[model samples]
Structure formats: structure tokens, C-alpha cells
Target: MPSPSRVLKLIALLLDYPSPDVRAESLALHALIRTAELPEARRDGLAALLDALCQGDLLDVQERYDSLFERGRALSLLLFEHVHGESRDRGQAMVDLLERYSAAGLAIDANELPDYLPLYLEFLALGDAEAARQGLVEVAHILALLAQRLAQRESLYAQAFEALLALAGVAPELAGQCYQAQQEAVDDSLEALDRAWEETPVSFTDPAAGCPSASPRRQPAGVEQPLQWVAQPVPQTHPRATR
Candidate 1:
């Protein structure tokens, strides 16, 4: 199988919280969209998102992201929330996911959870191509769900999920089954959010934590954590994805 595209890591970086680092690489990202293996339509959508990011002050971009993903559970970036909600099953699911990352030679950092979409994508980018494709297929329903939600709000972030679905090559017949089955009412209103996130997010990979890994061996200290996998751009250089 062909290896997964480095574009996966690029998308992960862009989907992450808005940072000046993104702005700094705007040119490279644009070049990537122009030359990536994605279909033209998908590339166009992603370009729109990148354009939106580079349009105005970084602060405005950051605020929009906060309003979209932070204030609501509907568009929350945590993948498991869409599947497991707040149920206890989510915790075990997270442990399983962490094991997958550890088995893949990753050691998590930044107290990030196992289910954060960006972190998940970075993990997939480093995996076997078939495995990465399967991983994207596994979550294609959630991608569809989020894409619909974001598009409904006229949010540009929908482009990112749409791009993911394209890469996943999800059969149209099965694409929306789980998404269409979501019948619960989400309460991510202003007041609900005010009471939410009262505590810090937990990170299972924190070496300080005693949570032991079942992997054959532990990742030795001082390694590339998450989000650092994106091959960066160099000035006046031809930009290419490393994978």
C-alpha cells in the first residue's frame, strides 16, 4: 500500500488551536493544497479554510475556533465524545487508543487526550498506509457528522472533515449511517459550557503518571511527542510532504 500522505499531518496542524506557527507556514500550506494528491474539489475546500485562516488577524481566527469547537459539544474535536459521550466506556476506549499510539512508537505529551482529532491524525500519519486508511474509515461517520454540523453553521472548518472523508474513500452508502442515527439532544449552550471543563484534561502518556503501557517496551524519555510530525517548510524551497 502507498504510505499515508504527509498532508495528514498538515491538516492536523491546521485543525489544532490557532497559532502564529500556522500563519508562518501559510505559504507552504497553500503550496501543499496546490500540489497534494487530493481531488481538486477537496483541495479547493481546504484552500478556502486556509484562506479564511490567513484572511484577518490571528486573534479573530482563534476566537472563531473557540466559538465553534469550545463552546459546544456538537462540534467538539474530541472524537470519542461523538461516539461514547460522557459514558464510562469513553475512559476505557481512551486507554485502548493510548495503547494503540504507544504501540505505534508514540509517547504523548501536552496532557492531550487519546481522542483529540488532531492527535489522532498525527498518529495515523505515522502508521502503515492500510492501517491509516482503516483508521480514517473507522471515523468517517464522525467526520461526516462534524462536516454536516460545521457546514450548517457556514463554518469553514467543515472543509477539513470533508477532506478527511475524501481521503478515507468511504463508500457513500455507509458514510452517514452512524451520523444519521444520532438522535440525542446536545446541550452545549452558553450556560452548559460555563459549567464545563472545570478540571484539566488527563493525559495517560504522561510519564509522571503511573499508568503503565502493555506495549513490549516503554518509549524512552525525550522523544517527539505529538504534532511535531508535520514536516515543516523552508524559505524559498520547494515544499513537499515527507511521507
Candidate 2:
């Protein structure tokens, strides 16, 4: 079996936004996939996605990503979004997850939420392989739903989710149940999709509600806080009446 870290790295690469240098990135990604030592089916699925990404126009890829992930809540990349939406529960969940990342010395960028798929994958990539696999399995239902939705749209990105399911060792019957539950819950119409994104804002005011104060706070790695200096007036010695 391929190490969990290696599998996660490939998933993270796929989840990232296709930059202007995507062609070159795709080339490199393909090389990694070739030696990933994944099962034949999983490897081929990943390779197919790479081929599609490399062959497509960068603009189309960017637009598709935005439409699928950013504009629509049904396909949002943030894991908690699927579970909690704009509810207070989601805020609390985010705070708890942020603390977990902090404990692991994983520094998330200010603009990136800890629940984002790519960030989550990066965190997994840095952890114990067995633990990562267990974590992935815990979220297997989410992955399965994502795969089903993407496959419904005939998007190549569906392959990434499929690869994740394979890595997590999710049984086909379980995956089917997850997909069926998601489909039943989601309306999937254009209006319904739009409404899903129009969620009310969530605020975390109570310290007890979010990250508990009891949890120790550690500065994220690679971030430096500027030193605070208290302003003090310098004593001016009266020029000995040098008149």
C-alpha cells in the first residue's frame, strides 16, 4: 500500500486552484502519480484527471472550480460547510479544528479556513499514516457525496474524491448509502443551490462556546508576531546654559 502521506499529497495537489503555471504543475503531478504505488484503478483515475487538467484551458478550469466550489454550497470544499452550514455549530467546529491544527504545529493562513479540503489534506500529510487513514475514514461519507455530485456533472475532479474513498477503504455499499442520503437531502436545482449559499453569518461571542480557554494556545509555525514596544519619552538634559 502507498503511504498515506504520499496519497494525501496527490489529493492536495488536485484540490488546489489551477494556477497560471498549471501545465507545468500538471506535468509534475503526473510524475508523482506514476510512482505513487497506488492501486491500478485509483492511479488511472488520478492520471485521467491530470490529463484533463493539462489539456483544458486554464480559464475554463478556474471558472469550473469557482462554480463548483466557491459559488455553490452543495459542493463547497470546506468540510464543515457540508455538516453545519452557517449554524453556530459550524463556528464551534471550526474553532475546535483550528486548535487541533495548532496542536500539530500546522499553521493555516489567515485567509484559509482550517476546514478547507486542501488544508485538511496538508494536515493529514504531515501526520502518522495510520492516523491519517483513520481520519479520512471518519469523513468518508463527505468524500463519497462529493464524488457522486462531481461525477453527476461529469467533472474530472470527481476522480480525486474517488481516489480518497479508495484510500480510506470505504466499502461500496457504504459509499452508496452516503450518496443516496446526500441526494435525498439536496434539491440540486439552480434556485436551491443558490439558496444554499445564502446562509446567515455566524458569530462566536462566548469564549466557552468556541475554543475553550482551557486549551493551551501555541503560535502557528512560520508566523512571527512583532514585538510590542511601549513608547517612553527620552529625558532631555537641559544644555548646561551654554549661552
Give me the displacement of residue 180 in model 1, in angstroms: 3.6
Over 92-127, each residue of candidate 2 has an lDDT whose tens digit, in order, gives 565677667676678765545666777777776777
Give the C-alpha lDDT of model 1: 0.64
Summarize candidate 1's per-residue lDDT along 160-230 as a digit string, tens digits. 98888777776433565434433434455667675444323223234665533222232322223322111
Best by lDDT: 1
Q: In angstroms, what RMSD does candidate 1 have relative to the true structure?
A: 10.9
- The Cα local distance difference test for each model comes to 0.64, 0.61
Q: State in Å the error of residue 130, model 1.
A: 1.8
What are the runs in model 2 whose C-alpha is more than 4 Å off?
178-192, 198-243
> How close is every model to the real structure, measured as TM-score?
0.73, 0.73
